[model samples]
Target: MKQIFAFMPTFLLSVIFCNAQKLTATDVNSPEVTVVVDIKVNPQFKSEVKSLVPELSALTIKEAGALSYNYYLSPDGNKILIIEQYKSLSAFQEHGKNLFSGPLGQKFRSSFTVNSIVVAGGNLPDSVGNFTVMKSIGGFNSKCE
Candidate 1:
């Protein structure tokens, strides 16, 4: 799998990763787990945040067990949306550890406020405060097939 991704250009990788967010599995661990995080950023630091997006995203999708990880700016340019999908809960946790302990995580803590965290795939705690939960009914992505 690593070799398959190895030959693709970085931008193409990003497109694939971003598109994978909308796909689903028929069962838990089949389609994998996903986390949609909404990050709130003020106008001042938007460029700084955007500057780091591509590098950060490239690093993430290359990691073992990483299915998807990408960021988007809201229409107003004040909000950041991170769409993450992992092959398993463990993979998601691995990404989380890297996220909080790595440079990107540090930058995020100092520069942005977390607006929301939502879980999908029935893996862990469902409704905690502002979180929304989702279960995959059915879907298909040619890339996954």
Candidate 2:
């Protein structure tokens, strides 16, 4: 109806304004940090990669200060995206140290090739090596119950 169409723009504008406020109100200094890792599983190691995922996720989720550790596999199953969130930057650094040192790390390295790593939120203490870092300007992260 004409009446519904006339009110649609106002409704949309209000929604946009509310979203803008949420972004602008975000705390850039929040200590939480999230890392997204993109990797391609080697053809020969596809089965190995699949097997390693559960073990790796279990260990990671048990680590201190780990907020969440999740992996997403592409439809073709050749690529994987890992999303990890930490309570703080220190926690993230500790996880990296642990991950790059042991037998698990070696097995992981042999299974997949890291294509890219993107870090978001918090101030990084040192360079992330080959990673692309993104600072939070305006955004919000929802906490799930």
Candidate 3:
């Protein structure tokens, strides 16, 4: 009983220190940044919009800096979630150029009722808003076979 209480404080301290140290050490080195987009489309547009996911992803992945671009449909079928990863800030910026200014991106915009974006990374882009940024902890990103 006494030993358990004594170890609790030590355990907590270790956990805090380990997490802090880990965040400090590698957060800057984590160059991969991601954009998560949540889209709610008018029901009439749902089927048409869903069909375009592969097209968008395919074009995005062909770019030099895109690590991955995937879109998922919510079970209820009204919402779409797009997860896009890039190798660096510059890559993300390059994506931003197409996202608003290009024809394919216009198609993406025309499909959704509401499009909310959240950028997550060690460093957030200054030009974008509405982000849920975070320091990297630890994880591995592997390509799907």
Which candidate number maximizes lDDT?
A: 2
Candidates ranked by lDDT: 2, 1, 3
Winner on TM-score (1 vs 2) = 2
Consecutive 10-residue window with the lowest summed lDDT within model 2: 17-26
For every candidate structure, what is the RMSD over all alpha carbons to the true structure, in angstroms?
8.5, 8.1, 10.7
TM-score of every candidate relative to the true structure: 0.67, 0.76, 0.67
Clashing pairs in model 1, backbone N/Cα/C closer than 3 A: none
Model 3: runs farther than 4 Å from truth?
1-28, 125-127, 137-145
Q: Which model, 1 or 3, shows the larger lDDT?
A: 1
Please provide, for model 2 over 1-145, each residue's C-alpha lDDT reduced to its tens digit, 9 standing for 90 to 100.
9989999998887776664432335677888888999999989898777789987877687788899998999979899999999988788888888887878888889999999998888566446667788888776654322
* Per-residue alpha-carbon lDDT of candidate 1 for residues 49-133, written as tens digits (9 for 90 to 100): 8777876787687779788787888778888888998877678778778878878887778778888887787445545345677
Best by TM-score: 2
Query: What lDDT does the true structure give each of the candidates?
Result: 0.74, 0.82, 0.73
Q: In candidate 3, which residue pairs get closer than 3 Å at backbone N, Cα or C atoms, i.e. clash?
A: none
Clashes of each: 0, 0, 0
